[model samples]
Target chain A: MVLTERAREHARALVRGLKAARIEVVASVPDQWIGLILEEVAKEGSFRSVPVAREEEGIGVCFGAVLGGKGAAMLMQNAGLLSSGTGLVTLHLLHQVPLLLLVSYRGTPGDPLFYHIPKGVRTEPALRALGIPYFLTDAGKDLTAQVCRTWTYARESAGPAALLLTADLFAGEDVYP
Target chain B: MRTSRVAYMQVLADLVVDELVVCGLGASARYWKALRPRPENFYLADSMGQAIPVGLGVALAQPARRVVVLEGDGAVLMNAGCLSTVASTGATNLIVVIFNNDVYEASGGQPLPAAPVDYAGLARASGLALATNLEGADAFRSALQKALKEPGPAFLCLRTAYLPDEPIPAYDMRPLETRLIFMQSLGVSI
Candidate 1:
């Protein structure tokens, strides 16, 4: 599927934000909305991109990266986040390792697919339950700044923080039809 | 005859100096902590099946230092997919040592349903070139030395026997404290 200009721009902004935050390593389990972002990350020279088999494995990777004194982020979808609760709690939260999570907010109101609704409904509550602070991306807001801020907060707090990418940030009219 | 887990750990403790160690949860952590009480040794208190993934991350971030992971058979079975993930990274600085006791020794010696998994074959099939299975402490030590010197993401499975009566010192440090000390040792400011 061809990515819309809007999606491309958003992907670029996300990569730029990761650069601004000095994220040296990224562990990703791909999602449809974040594929372009992953592509951008792979193309970026300064970042080490690790493609993991599972979401929880990505969490462990980020945790180890941070422990090695590198800025790291996990890129995945909300469903992956739901599946990663154990690692997030046992490795990141229990040890207080700073991790920046860039997650696609799938199954939301803007999403046309009915199957995504189940994961969308539980994303925020799951985040809250896990004690992970998160920020939702607004269509009008600057994504780069939002990512940078989230990274900073995770570093300063020495805990995990998430930035959820809403559908409006990447999808155009073509995404619906 | 199966080798003693403690003996293999002692071999590791004696051989490791500058390499970073990531120990799996339960007995692996306890035994490693008791043997190698240092900041470079990151003892996992609760996270089972994540030692290899964490070590892979450390190896990727710090390419100069060797990152060794001490994983149990049960933990490896739980997260066997990590072997593929680690191999895909093509990290030459990581080494995985699985202590295969044929049971979850830490969780009350429950026998693993799939006992005696050929982990070395699994690793080789997963793309790790330097993978071997050893049955004795001397063999493990030799393999570990070779794995450390070679340029590879190596995997070593040591067939070990469980000693329920062996006294392993209790790990008193909290998980947060463990993380801080480990970061400090690595000189990681963040």
Candidate 2:
């Protein structure tokens, strides 16, 4: 997967936002679109990155971090968001722990992969059903500010909030084969 | 003779001090809440199979404080993959103690498939710094004492008896309140 200059910059901005929000721990499950951001997080060194085996496990980790009084986020693809419903409800929602969810909004309009379409379509509805507030990214907008705001909303609400990264944000026109 | 779950927990309550404790859902959590209802103890009343992962997070966040997790056989088997993740982190402050009663004591006394699985072996193979399976009250007390004193990401599996009619007091704290009080106890304001 080739990452475009714009995508790299967006990744950097997202990492900057996380740092600005003082998110100390990030639990992630990789997606092609979010790989650059995860890489940036590693290079940035401001957050502790935990690569989890499953998406639900990431939820548990983030919940624990929040309980310990540190800011936390979960990075994964929209499919992972779909798979993590039970944990989201039982742990974060039931317990009212604040967690920022950074998800690659795959299978959307510009996405080339047909398999991702289902997840893209169901993402918003899933979040709604889970009662998690979300924000969608736009290439024209400042991603750092968007991320910071989403984090703030999560913290203030004392519940999970999601920031969905669109293909445009990642400049994915020719990145995928 | 199989050791009673309460006996093992009694030993733990007597030994544990300032360490943060994460208890898994079901009877184990209910028992812990009754035995030591302290803010330092974070009881997961409903989320099954998540205690270890949460404990790992707490351990990572507070490296200075030891995090001991109380897990049940059924719950651990449900999320056994977390053991590998915990091992990978190599967080020396985390300790997982699995009470293997060979049944889902919380839901009912449903026998976990009759396979004689070695939980300690699984944890060892997963690369934990220390792993041991113990039986009897004497063995668990000594092992737990050693685990507290040692530097390790440890896993201890204790063979316990199934209590069909264990009297577990109702956990009255709401989920949000529990989260807040526990955070307050940890001196974290957010």
Candidate 3:
């Protein structure tokens, strides 16, 4: 199914914002909430799209992209955050590789998906525990500025940062199963 | 038909020409660092199963340059999903050389499963352009030559002997220092 107009605009803004931040590579695993955003990212000619099999692999890809002198962003859902904990600690955190994680905040309040709830509850805690800073954005928030700031903070700190996209951000779109 | 892990790494190191080399944790990193202690070579100290994806990224970002990943069998098993990703992305300039000793040499000399996997087959199944299982120095040399000359996301599974004999010095450099040098070598302004 095609994305709604609001969802499409949000995705486009994210893609454009990342490009403005000089993000040359976008490595991602598909999530229902961010699927259209990932597609928009792929269509951006300036950014090289890399679709990985898993979240940890995307983290590794982003690590290498930064090492090669290009900025990188990883897009995934909250469950992917748990899958990427090892890579987050050992690679990005340890080596001070700056990675922008554009995570879909699944299982947040008002979301009906029960399986994703636990991960959503733990997402903020996990980010805090790892000492990685994050900014949670809802539909009402200014996402363009938040995304750019997240990129800046990650690059400046030489660590991973997360832009948690709330469920409401994909409002009017059929993202849930 | 077995090959020394150190010898194999040394041979491949000689073959590399200004390519970004990423070494997985454990013996792979140790041997590569010992052979070629250069700014371009990233010896990942702790992240297991990350070497290939990192190399794939470098290959993607810098399409003109070659990127090599020297990974251990156990480490690759930790993130074997990367194999399919590498194939799917179709980065032709990337080469993955697995030092398949079939043992966890870093933690202890524990034997892996007796029924060894067909890694070359796995790579081929995963959609790499070229995949081969090589034993002895000649076969490996030949495969490396072919892979270098050809356009491919290639995979080479090298049968190595599990040698815990040579206790190398611990890696002294910090991760930040290595990162700086590597980016500088890549001509990427930090």
| Clashing residue pairs found in predicted model 3 | none
For candidate 3, write residues B100-149 as lDDT tens digits: 88998877778766776888887888787588888987788888988888
TM-scores for the candidates: 0.97, 0.97, 0.95
Candidate 2 docking quality: incorrect, acceptable, medium or high: medium
Candidate 3 chain A weakest lDDT stretch, 10 residues: A168-177
TM-score, prediction 3: 0.95
- After superposition, which runs of candidate 1 have C-alpha atoms over 4 Å from their true positions? none
Give the distance in Å from residue B68's predicted Cα in candidate 1 to where it truly belongs: 0.9
Candidate 2 lDDT (Cα, 0 to 1): 0.89
Q: Report the C-alpha displacement of residue A28, candidate 3, in angstroms.
A: 0.8
Q: Can you write out model 3's per-residue Cα lDDT over A1-177, one digit (the tens) per residue?
A: 335788788888888779878898898988776898977776877788888888999999999988888899999998898879999999988988899999988887746578878988899999898898999875666677778999999989989999988877675546554
lDDT of 2 by residue, A11-125 (tens): 9999999999999999999987778899999999868899998989999998998888889999999988998888888898898888999999988887867898988889999
Q: Individual DockQ of the candidates?
A: 0.82, 0.78, 0.76
Task: Estimate, for each residue in B35-82, the C-alpha lDDT of model 2 and write its tens digit.
Answer: 889999898978898999999999999999999999999888888888
Instruction: Summing lDDT over every window of 10 consecutive residues in candidate 1 chain A, give the lowest-scoring window.
Output: A168-177
In model 2, where do residues sit more than 4 Å from their true spots? A175-177
